[model samples]
Target: MARHAGLQGAGRQRHGYFEHWRRKDAGKPSKLGANKRISDEALLVHIKAIHAEVRQEYGWPKMWKELLARGIRVGKERVRKLMQRHGIKARGKRKFVVTTDGKHDLPIAPNLLARNFSPAAPNQTWSSDITYIATDEGILHLTAINDLFTARWWAGCPTGPPDQESCSQASRSFRYRSANGRPLADNRWR
Candidate 1:
């Protein structure tokens, strides 16, 4: 038993595992070599340059990958720690905007339909709505109208600015269909 204990102690000492329990210098900064400190600063400069070149969007994971591609030997966590320490962070997603404004003193339209979607016949009840769509170019506003009974789409217009006049004009000009095999309403564009 004594021999076994002695052997275990010897193995621990050999592997320098005792250092794990030893106290470190808490007050003073680490005594890194001059060359190491200089290299660390140089790495930080390179990181900042890359961040700016990428429009400051790349986070630590991507930055770590970039560093790896540039032949910089660094860990991902180390890069994260460095970024956090230097106050570097990635941009967040944009917030959605509410396009509707209800604060105006204009006369509010009464809900004639009253959520009664079942219409007696085609064109008996029409529904209109507008929504905004995000795209690569920019936000697109789509205004559309449909018949509640026939489920037929009456009119639709996609505009950039989404003004009220254009939407009303577009819907008003939309005639149902005529022959030449269009729809059913006589659509004559004047």
Candidate 2:
């Protein structure tokens, strides 16, 4: 079309249009690069270095400290700016431990006494268990009878290791409590 207007050679100087396109697209390079304080590679390398040091647990401030220790003459703001640009940060997590064992061979006891914390009266329901306490004398095995209705310890016995007295004490405590009127727990025991 230019040739049709007798301007065949005029359009040859169109290379300057590229400069106009550059100015429009990138906006005349501001004094921005006049101070490209840090190189892209150096900033990324330092960030990765700090991450390796702290296992990625160091934020901008701590990383800044490390940078200073390394004799890097940069300020915290610059570090923060770089880190923010790259979305680098440190955060925390909630700590909880879960433990489960589904392979035990022991039989789960039947809930014969399903949380009957209430008994018609004292000795009507009893819960007994064995625990241990220590004195200067030695480790003592313990057995106790709790009155579900009264919420009181009516009987307790403690003995040293190698003693089979725990079973006997538990039996006697359970008997005495039930003799008052309650039934021996399930009524099928000696």
Per-residue CA lDDT of candidate 2, range 1-190, in tens?
Answer: 4423533446634445445556668877443233446666696697788787787798999988888788565778888988888888886653543334567786655676776666676656666655666577866767666667777765556666524565566657667656664432332111
lDDT of 1 at 137: 98
- Show where candidate 2 strays beyond 4 Å: 1-103, 162-165, 177-190
**lDDT per residue as tens, model 1, 77-134:** 8889889999987777689676778888877665677777786766666666666888
- Residue clash pairs of candidate 1: 177-185
Q: What is the C-alpha RMSD of each candidate to the true structure, in Å?
A: 10.6, 15.5
Give the lDDT of residue 52 in candidate 1. 94
lDDT of model 1, residue 100: 73
lDDT leader: 1
Pairs that collide in candidate 2 are none
